[model samples]
Target: MARWSNWSGRQRSKPVAVQFVRSESDAAAIVRTANSAGRTVRVAGAGHSHSPLVVTDGVIIDTSGLAGVISTDAQQRRAWMWAGTRIHALGRALHDAGLGLVNQGDIDRQAIGGAIATGTHGTGASLRNLSAAVVGARIVLASGDVIECDRNRYPELLEVARLNLGSIGIVTRLQLELRDAYRLREQAWQAAFEDIAPQLESLARATRHFEFFWYPQTDMAHAKAIDETNAEPVYPLAAEGERCAYSYEVLPNDRPHLHTEMEYSVPAAHGLSCLDAIRTLIRRDFPDVRWPVEYRTLAADDVWLSTAYQRDTVTISVHQDIAEDETPYFRACEEIFLNYDGRPHWGKVNYLERETLAKIHPRWQDWWQARERIDPRGTFLNDYLRRIRPR
Candidate 1:
């Protein structure tokens, strides 16, 4: 068994033992061994999480070796990929097969299982979290029993398991819903903070996806609009503006000033007003501030626990330099965020505890109940999971 820890190095918890289960039988055997010994077990993937969900003093199953895509059903609009599959590799495979993920997060290094477990997502008014795209999954329960989960089988568990946070069991296989691959046309521009607010709603409606970034302490902002369109003929650029759509030289690789970020998803109807108020509060009240304020949008979906469950949303992601303590800044932002009925992303840093988060997520209690059923002993649980969904 290989050992691992999360990205931030904030909290470290090691397992009592570790094992690499290459197959279903191997996973089953490992579970049986743990059950017999009366020990808890958890699955560890990319470990990109900032939270301590993967931390455990018990048995840990490393799924890195369980790699490969099992099958694809074009007619069914689905493909079965192994749990260890990383987003970058999976995207390439899907693209080669003329299918692509419905959407993807900014970072592509996370494995499928972990992403689904934590509900990783990207921004777009028409997109939902990655977990929402899961049609089925093969999970290994604590009892060493394996089962297929979907709307038809284990219907109740299926809903919660999509974003199970690894509480239910180790997800070994995933059946994803994909669409025909398409190219995205992206446009970038700068705008004033006040000016952006009025056009936000219109811009989001006009584009397939829209994102904005504001430099804190300054009124300057940058916005990007991406739209899906017919494949354009591959042509050489006239030797001026970097020559091509996918050319790396055309993209800026420069890193921006680092900052402590706190992002929140607010209902789309409050998009302009919320952004406006936040900008005003930060600029007028906190003049010494200097960080980027970013925003993105996504369409509503059926994922019960998704931030965009039944409402189109605008995500306001604010960044503050690492040198600055974010307490006061985030405190100010939280007032506006909460006033707009915002839901913070699970993976990002935030201060809201479980009780308050529960109100924003109406299904929090139900999902917590289902999580308890699968991990009654808190085998796969961690401090963050406990905080958000305490048993």
Candidate 2:
């Protein structure tokens, strides 16, 4: 089978010709196939990432066939999903059953397997990233063995697997904690960028899902509020088969176009100042360029490496039309995030190396150690792991 390693059809790296592996047993068979052939192996879900997380020259195990909703334990508020299930499918299925994930990122096309591996998150003042909801997982080791791990069974491995970044092993299944079905009343509007800093924190506290976007060189900002309340709620439930109109489409309907974006999570305390700094720099240096700045809020989570690990966060996402030169603006924003100890979302573009990533993550050492024990030969690693834990 032909396996192409690419992201969103934008950037593509080397091809790791691969075949679909349907189940844990099928994954084991693929491992045996690669091992016997003396070829390295890697596993990828929907290939939604912008990074080279799965750029391998050897066998690539396609896990989409390993799809299913194993079960849901309402009492425990947990659900078991196969690794390759897409986020949209999972969300719709769960919603139909009167259940929903605690939080979900804007795009639902990413596979659950890939989302958790890369620390993908949705905006919310009270919701954590998807990975943090993972209570346990079924990972296939390099030795062709299936191992079920959790905080108790393999506590060490569980710590690593929580945000493993596809470095440790091939995750075949995931056990996630679920929340009661909820509705999000979305309010989209424009606001002045200067006025957002002081009010950002208070606004997050008032809403459940709040995200906004800022454009470079512009003082204008676009914000969305997805709050929960029994009061008169607007924006009725999205109809079946209707796709969510993303920020880009929602704003400037006549001039919809692709855009480049970068997102970061700052400590709830540092949020205001972070936004202030960006505005100050933009207003002072690049006042001519204009795009709306987007912000979103998410609740705290318990995962060791989650963005909202211990503190609440306000995610400020900046975007520029794809046709525009975004490198300079993105570079400037990266510097701001670095100064504020910002944690970049894994699926998005970030220039963080292992040394830098280690500083932001206290569990980095523990995760790498466990990964070594699980995949000593680095069977599941790609260029991304090399960046995170260079040889």
What's the lDDT for residue 364 in model 2? 65
Candidate 1 deviant stretches above 4 angstroms? 1-3, 17-19, 35-38, 233-260, 284-289, 320-324
Q: 289-325, model 1: which lDDT tens digit per residue?
A: 7777778887777676777778888888776665667
* Candidate 2 off by > 4 Å: 1-5, 229-259, 283-291, 320-326
Please give the CA lDDT of all the candidate structures. Answer: 0.74, 0.72
lDDT of each residue in 1-391, candidate 2, tens digit only: 3547454444455544677888888888778777777777777888877667777777777888988788887777788899999876786566555567877777776789999987888776667787888889998877788999987898877777778778777899999988766654456777777676567777777876666777655556677766554443234434322214322112112223455567788887787788778777777776765776556676777676776767777777766655677778878988998898888877666777888888887666766777788887777777667667834
User: Which residue pairs collide in model 1, if any?
Assistant: 124-297, 124-298, 125-297, 125-298, 125-299, 126-299, 214-293, 216-291, 259-320
